[model samples]
Target: MSDQLNTRQARRQAQKKKQNSNNKGKSKKQLIKKIAIATAIAIAVAIIATGITVFAIISNAPELDEEQLMLTQGALMYDQNDEFVSQLESSERRMNVSISDVPSVVQDAFIAVEDIRFRDHFGIDIRRLFGAVAANITDGFGAEGASTITQQLVKNLFLENDKLMSRKIQEQYLAIKLEQQYSKDQILEMYLNQIYLGSGVYGIELASQRYFNKTVEELSLADAALLAGIPRRPSFYDPTVNPEAAESRRNLVLSLMVQHGKITEEEAAEAEAISIEEQLDVTEREAYAYEAFYNLVLNELEEIDGITSSDIYNSGLKVYTTLDTDAQEHVETVLQTSEYIQNYPDNEDFQAAITLLDTETGQIKAVGSGREDSGQQRGFNYATEAKRQIGSTAKPLLDYGPAIEYLQWSTGHMITDEPHSYSDGTEINNFDGTFQGRMSMRRALAASRNVPAVKALQEVGTDRAKEFGEQLGMSIDTMHESYGLGAIPLSTKDLAGAYAAFGNNGTYTQPYSVRKVEFPDGRVLEFEPESQMAMSDYTAYMVTDMLKTAVTDGTGGTANISGLPMAGKTGTTNFDRDTREQYNIPANAAPDIWFAGYTTKYTAAVWTGFNQHSENNYFPSQDSSRQIAQQIFKAVVEEVSSTIETPDFTMPNSVVRVGVERSTGYYQVILRQVVRLFMNYLYVVMSRLEYQKNLSTLNLLAI
Candidate 1:
């Protein structure tokens, strides 16, 4: 009985212990389950938060403009007469073609290389996106791009190119919207049209034309593959720029087509074997005939508010320029024809630039950038771009103009033309290497005497001279006396526009190329240069009179147009002693020569020289080369003046002609006083002699 009782008690104790162990195991399992539930809740919350953020960003994305998906038109340029000149040069060169015109093989070539799943996916390819994300995570950000054709199209049309997350979200959102609106065929067609290909080409059609000189419809499999590869890296895969790299890229595209089962392996092999150069028949787009003027118009367009170079090329903008086609043609003829510019150097490297402007309006009538057409689009525009040392042309604008304006000096004002030096002991010499002792300002200016010009600038003060020059559209940044001799460089455009102040009765208008810009949105931007008074009327007249003497009997004589009332100046810049010694240049050789002149109706500036000056590349001392600028100026003015009725430069009422002694440059009033005093002395002498004779006779009678 006792053992039974003990055994029952032990069993009861064992049961209690087993029950406690079971309760502990249940508590452990319950804690783990709670932890798992919390973790799942956190993940679910995070996913919901991300979804909300993405939806917010997508909702704020830009609305797609269906019209922008169409082909964009290039800007149109017109002349002063409103006649079409040429289409403005743009970075985007596109020729739109319908989807039907593109061959199936060419379409498949793009689809295979650009986006293999283009046909089946929505605008955003989820599989490709996930693969790109995984690749990025494994490597780094931007390791791969998963943008579909639709995404790229939307980015090009409506989105800024950046790597921002918001931009990516918006791009994807727009792509989806675009897919919902257009069919797959339509999207592909738009992509082919909007995609940027190599060599400034924007579409497959233009790419076909640019590379093969053929249409997209006529492209072979290899040709289509070559074009298809360029959009990936346009410059790197440009056939003309990098033929080998382009061929390799093309082969890769062909292989991709085979892998995607769009083309047979045999077809891919055959296409890869063909050399890119063999199929290439590069068609260079012909530049506009008036490319110089067109380039000027384009430059002006860039300055307009809200107008960019892309807008000028793709916005279908209409630009009316100040170009007078007849004058432009005549100017070109004069610069190109040997007969007109008989003094042009025989060397092909010799270049010339000229700018002609209407006197009163400051309109750029014509511009000649080079003596010979370079046949390059937007080549160096010397007329507006090349700034060379103006030489002695600075005399009238920098030195004497300020002198007369500030000092009220007349044309007869005297200046000594002798060996001189600045206060800093810098020697100044005349161009002819000899100096006249003293002469009227008119004679000094007409002869372009360097010493007198420097002296005039000294008397007027460099500060005042610079201020005066600035009023005339010159950017004078130096206070040195050499500036008086045109050590400062200026373009033909600046010279021509500045000289117009004299003919315009002291009014200066900034020269402009484009008259107006008309946008596709019906907004017109007219560019009318504001007129400012650069000098007093009498000051202008005085300078004009002196310049007239320069043209008639001075260094500018070579540029004079017969029977045309004109005022002009000539300028020549020389190499320094060190340069001359280094290059073994002759004493008479110059780097740049200029003739800036204006008739009553027009103003023109001509510059002639080698683009760069070396011992063998300089303008020789020969009459033809040295006087080439003058001769060209004469021809250009003669041609342009034939069409306009040129009148004489009108003298203002405040300007009066005064007589002065040519020898002494003394005023006529002072000479008249001397004559009167001399006559009075003679009369007194005669009266005194008569009195002496009468006294002598009286003395004789007394004796």
Candidate 2:
């Protein structure tokens, strides 16, 4: 009975072990099934999120404007007379050509190198896109791009050049949309017209004309291949700039053509044999007639609040400028042609710049950037850009103007012109190295004496002088006694604007070139310069009177025009001893010479010197070179005044002319002497009465 019971217990124990193992296997299978279901749900959610984000981005893309895809027009500039002057040089110089006119070989060359499977694929090449994506994933984003010709066209037209993912999506979406709307031939034509080739040229037609001086239909296979290679890197592969690089690129394009079966190997070899230089006949575009004034307009456009240089170049805007064409032409002629000026310098290195402004409006009417047109577009503009030291011209503007405005000093206020030194013990000397003592303020300013100007600045205070200069639009960076003798540097534009205040009865109007800009969509941007009272009318008159005397009898005598009611100041800057020794310059040589003058109708500032102050370039002590600025100023004033009716400078009612004795430098010495004699006689009579009264008192005491 014990053996049978033991067998039953063992059987039950084995059955229980088998049941536990089966239950563990079932639990493992159930866990695997639940994980698979959760993974599928997560992937579906990710797909939905990506789809929604892409859809939002595509919806927010810029609306397609078919008209903008057409050939772009350059901005136009009109003069103050509302007359057409010239077309501004835009970023793209494209002349559209029909697809039928484009040679088949030319089209094949572009397609061979740019996009090999252009015709076989949709707007996006899926294989190339995937390869680029894989490359980017491995080497970080923005490492590669798979842009089709259609993609490039849309980006050039509508999108900013940025490496953002969103921008790329918008570009691709717009490209696909464009392909759907237009035929293949139309898209090809547009792409050819839109690509920037080189040398400020756009489109194959213009590129052909610019490089080969021929029509698009006349391009040889080598010529077409060379042009096709330039779009890869315009500046780097430009034939005129880098001929060897351009030739290498052209050969690569030919090889690409042969590889794609667009041309026979023998034909490709023949085309590659021809050097890029031989196939090229470069033709330069003629510079605009009003290039200097146009350059000023471009600079002004850049400073406007919302406008950019791209807008000026790409947008079909109309710029209305304050350029008086007649005055501009005259000024240019005077600067270029020596016959128009008197005592003109004969040195080739000698350069002169002049700026003319309407005194009442502060509008820049004419600007001569140099002695001649540099012919380089947007070259260094000396008139508005170059800054040089202004000499004695500062005396009237910095020293005396502030004195009269703040100190109320009469024109005959006495100031001794003697040898003096600054607070730092720097000795000041007159230009002639001699002092004329006890001179009136008017005479001292007319003579441009160094001592009196320093004295006047000391009396008014340097801080106040700088403040007064700032009010008149003069940039005074340092407060020093030498500023009274015109030690500060200023551009011709700056000087002209400052002097205009004197001519405009103390009102300062900020100088500007552009009047208004009219956009393509009927939006107009008007530029109204800031105007403020720079000084009282009395101060303006006092300074103008002194400067008038300066033109008539002082350093600016040569700049005086015969019939024009003008006031002006002359300035000359010298080299230090060290500079003279280093360059072996003459003792009397001047690095810069200026003649700044103005009429009631206009203000003109002329500067003449070498752009560089080397031994080979400097103004000698001869009258012609030293006084070139005056001659230019005189010529410009004579020519510009003839076109406009200029009235004399009107004296303000608040300013009164007072007579002073020339010898004593005071009001009527004769009257002062007579009053002194009468007072002495009255004192003698009173003394005699006092003595008699004293004698009477003594007699009464004795009684």
Candidate 3:
């Protein structure tokens, strides 16, 4: 009976234990399931937060201009016909792209260079990020770029290019968002368009046009590779200057295309046959007047208000400028001609400038700020800025007009040729001490006589000289000085215009750079020169008469031309404080030689000197300035003379011939001697008659 009871109890106990064990097992399973559910819910919330953050990130990017326009700079040049002559370019080129149409090979090459594993990963590649971070930690700078192509586009197009890691983090995050929202092709297209391809090519189309001068569709594999190669180092690999480097980079692109199987080995080999010329035929660096054009453009850019340089440099703009390509070429040719540059050996050390302007309207016909073959560095530009001393050229503009109009000094008025003391006791004299005791004022000027000029200026007064120059458009500051003997700091440009008063019939025409400027949108800015009458027509004629003599009979004789009315003057400054440089008697060669002259149609001035204001100590001992200056003027006049009709010279309407002495300033016409060979017979006959008459009268008196 105990065994049965024990067995029954054992069976009951076993059942109870089995129920408890199963309950325990069920509780364990429930706990495990709950933990799994909690983890999945947390993961889902995190994903929701990430999606919202990415959505917000993509919305805050740098917006792009709908119309892709490049920034351009240009200048205005008006021709005699008042037509636009030329336009110059001053900016980089940017290209546009099609998101889906981008060639896969080019896209893959970008990936290889910018970001590896681009296809398999999101915009932010953690593996690359970790490696970059580690390297940055050790290297102290983020030398390695962890940015994917999409991240780069985000930074370049939208986000500011900050060096901070925070910005980089934002870039990475935004890139990931961009990857999810836009297709791989779309990102690539944006990147190619945003990337800087140098040589003034911006968008893909322009790049194709600028480099290959063809359409994008026409690009071969090698050509495509070459285009891809420029962005990495545009200046360093510039094909114009460094073709080898550009070629090397191009080959690298070809190898990568071949390695990626985007192009076959055979295609890569054929690329060699295509040659660098086939890829990019011309380089913008080799463009005409590239430096001067850009320089002028940069200067003009300062006029606009509230525009960033980037907007000016990058925005694709169509600029209509005054630069004439043909004129620019000619100006360059004239500047580099043997006549202009060959004279300056070791020209790199010296600098000079020349400018040409129209007389009717003061539009700049041509301008050369420096030598043409001066390599890359344009030396000192004397055209607009260099203040050289104007020697005798300013005399006609100052002394002669005032002497004629105010002092009523006639051309034939006699003046002593001896030395005279000034207020400071400084003695001045004629070219030689042996002065013509008396001579006509016209002859003195024709001879470039110093004493007669001084006497006339003394009569006109120092203030009058200054006033006359001011009338002729010369700054009074330059006009007021004791150096009226020849000292005046002036530029070649101002000198030319001041002398143009003669060409304009004693009316000064101010120099003009922009004859007209028209915007691409048809807005025009035009300028017309106003003629400022500086002297009376009669006084002008008087001065021109003397100046004509200067060219015809004075030191300016070298510049004389018959059959055309020409007037000019020669000037020399003292190489020493005591001697003149232009008309210097101390040195055989004049320091600064100028022949400022005018015909009916043109007023031209030429000045030749060393680049620096070398000390007056070194006498200009070679080349009479008259020779070269007149040669240049003569050549220019001859070249352009036939284009214009000869101008008529109207003589002075009235002449005030005062009763000044012929031999002296006093009223005296002293006759000296007259001899005749047959006078002996007449004298004999008269003596015989006089004697007979006296005898007859004496006999009549005696009777």
Cα TM-score per model: 0.64, 0.64, 0.52
lDDT digits (tens) for residues 92-124 of candidate 2: 377889999999989998998888877866678
Clashing pairs in 2: none
- Model 2 poorest 10 in a row by lDDT: 680-689
Whole-model Cα lDDT of every candidate shown, in order: 0.80, 0.80, 0.59
Off by over 4 Å in 2: 1-62, 65-70, 89-285, 373-378, 668-703
Q: TM-score of the candidate numbered 2? A: 0.64
- Candidate 1 backbone clash number: 0
TM-score of 1: 0.64
Q: Residues 1-703, candidate 3: write the lDDT tens digits.
A: 9999999999999999999999999999999999999999999999998777665654554344223321234333334455544333333344455756566666766676567677778888789988988988888656676888777666654454446655676787677777877777666776676565544344565666666667666666776777777765554454543567878888888787777667788988988666665556542334433345434433344334322222333432233333444444554555557653344444343434555555555545545565645432232345654567777776676666687777665555567777676557777755444577676666777777776677777778888888887776667664443446667777766877877776666677776554444443345445555777887666776677778878887878877876778888877765654544443345443456666777767666666555544333222444443366666566555545655686765654343222222222332111112112322111000112223433343221100
Q: By TM-score, is 2 or 3 better? A: 2
Error of 2 at 440 (Å): 1.4
**Residue 322, model 1, lDDT:** 86
